[model samples]
Target: MTRYEFVARAHAEGYSPPKEVTFAPSTRSEPHTHDQLSFVYVVAGTFILNTDRAAPAYQPGETCLLDANVAHAEEAGPQGATILVARKSGRVAETG
Candidate 1:
């Protein structure tokens, strides 16, 4: 497995605020960290979310929550995949 290099800029769709990213077939991303808490929703194809502790496969419609500054990586399935990534910076509201 090779380390994936992440681009500095966020990929997005026209007129849309959220970042949209696409992976090439058999693509593997290098471990990296995000500036803020984020969520990645898998729109098509499959991928594996790799972290320091675990690696889990994510399919279409599956969503993953990533904490701010957490180091992680991603591996795309053979057909590649499209994902929507949104970010936020704040504390989550607690339910009592």
Candidate 2:
């Protein structure tokens, strides 16, 4: 989806306004947990997301939603990655 669409959807889902984040080439983050839900939209390059269940590569136009307190790590691809992130506190709503 386009950035505009992503922002609109995120907001509709109760996410806060997005903030732009850029990761350096090949950068890696230690495993961590967030107090709030995280909504990430890959804007450029690639983002490799690691979690207990899986590790997936997210390319531009892809999105990832992480639940509150979930353990996760991230790595930037060789070309690095730029993403838009939004957050929401409390529990996320259930979907059918």
Candidate 3:
């Protein structure tokens, strides 16, 4: 049988995996690193993203590309944020 999904777990697929991550009204994750990564669609309410200071503050529909090892932090804790991130397991070749 064929199934349809609006959201899936990241563990389902190693690469280009789909996951539904939910955040509370005020939640922020610890700063982390990914050698090569890209964030696809982010359905957010209200949040602030931190990057190398070059990237502008993200808002709804505002997409940004983050380089590897770039110190970054985000605070959606104030009002809460939900983002669906997608990344490649290996070094990033290209992102658009």
Candidate 4:
């Protein structure tokens, strides 16, 4: 979806305003978790989102949603990536 659509959807879903984040070329992040529901929209280059079940590549105008506290990691494509992220704060129930 386009950035406009992404932001509109995110806001409708209760996410806070988005903030831009830039990842360096070939960069990778250690597995991590966020306390809030996360929404990410790729603005430039590529973003590889890694989860236990899959790793999907996101191009410009693409977006991804991650549930609160879900374990995941990120990798930046060779040319690097810029993304907009919005989050919704809330407690997520623990699952077995």
Candidate 5:
């Protein structure tokens, strides 16, 4: 469950908690799902994200928003990556 390391973590009043995570070069995460919505902001290096909808590569300053329960995987670039992520505490079930 812990594929990356958290360099920093903090919470703000009335806001979702934020974390800074770092992934080593060539590191990859197993397919996983989150119970809360995820907002990720790339800070340095590159990252490749594969989801049910698409497989896209992201660079520094790029951002990705993933809904809750969306199955996905991630891989760090050759130079590794550092990202800021905020996990909104909510189920946010998908509606059809």
Candidate 6:
């Protein structure tokens, strides 16, 4: 199995304001919400993502978006998943 590595960045490849957060194998996020409009691009591997509104399966190059105040969670595969997350920073805004 290949080891997974997560690279967290506030901005990547011209991804400004909202940045891309890369994740590794079996990476997870606590049930949380974001203030600004945010989303993710699955760079590699498979992952499961759950939110108040949906639970989606993501593959490489998949995209996800959520509004503020919405509870969300995630877990990647055994080999881990790579996620590029983009969101707003500073204040908590919006609601579930």
Please tell me which model should have the higher TM-score, number 5 or number 6.
5
The lowest-lDDT stretch of 10 consecutive residues in candidate 1 is 1-10
Whole-model lDDT, model 3: 0.53
Count of backbone collisions within predicted model 6? 3
Summed backbone clashes in each candidate are 2, 0, 1, 0, 0, 3
Best by TM-score: 2
2-88: candidate 5 lDDT, tens digit per residue: 213221322432226567889999898999998877767788889888897898888886777778888998889999988878787
Clashes of 2: 0
Q: lDDT per residue, candidate 3, 1-96, as tens digits?
A: 001221243335343664445567666567776675554344666555667564244555444445566667656655566666666554444455
Model 4 regions lying over 4 Å from their true place? 90-96
- On lDDT, the leading prediction is 2
What candidate 1 gets wrong by more than 4 Å, as runs, is 1-16, 91-96
Indicate the worst ten consecutive residues by lDDT in candidate 2.
Answer: 87-96
The deviation in Å at residue 4 for candidate 2 is 0.5
Candidate 4 lDDT tens digits, 1-96: 888998898889788999999999999999999999888999999999999999999999988888888899989999999999999876434355
Candidate 3: regions farther than 4 A off = 1-15, 89-96
Clashing pairs in 6: 21-85, 25-80, 26-80
| Segments of candidate 6 deviating more than 4 angstroms | 1-24, 88-96
Local distance difference test values of all predictions, in order: 0.69, 0.92, 0.53, 0.90, 0.73, 0.62
CA deviation > 4 Å runs, candidate 5: 1-15, 90-96
Query: Which pairs of residues clash in candidate 2, taking residues 3 or more apart in a chain or in different chains?
Result: none
Question: TM-score of model 2 relative to the true fold?
Answer: 0.90
lDDT of 5 at 68: 82
| Model 5 poorest ten-residue lDDT run | 1-10
Question: Which one wins by lDDT: 4 or 5?
Answer: 4
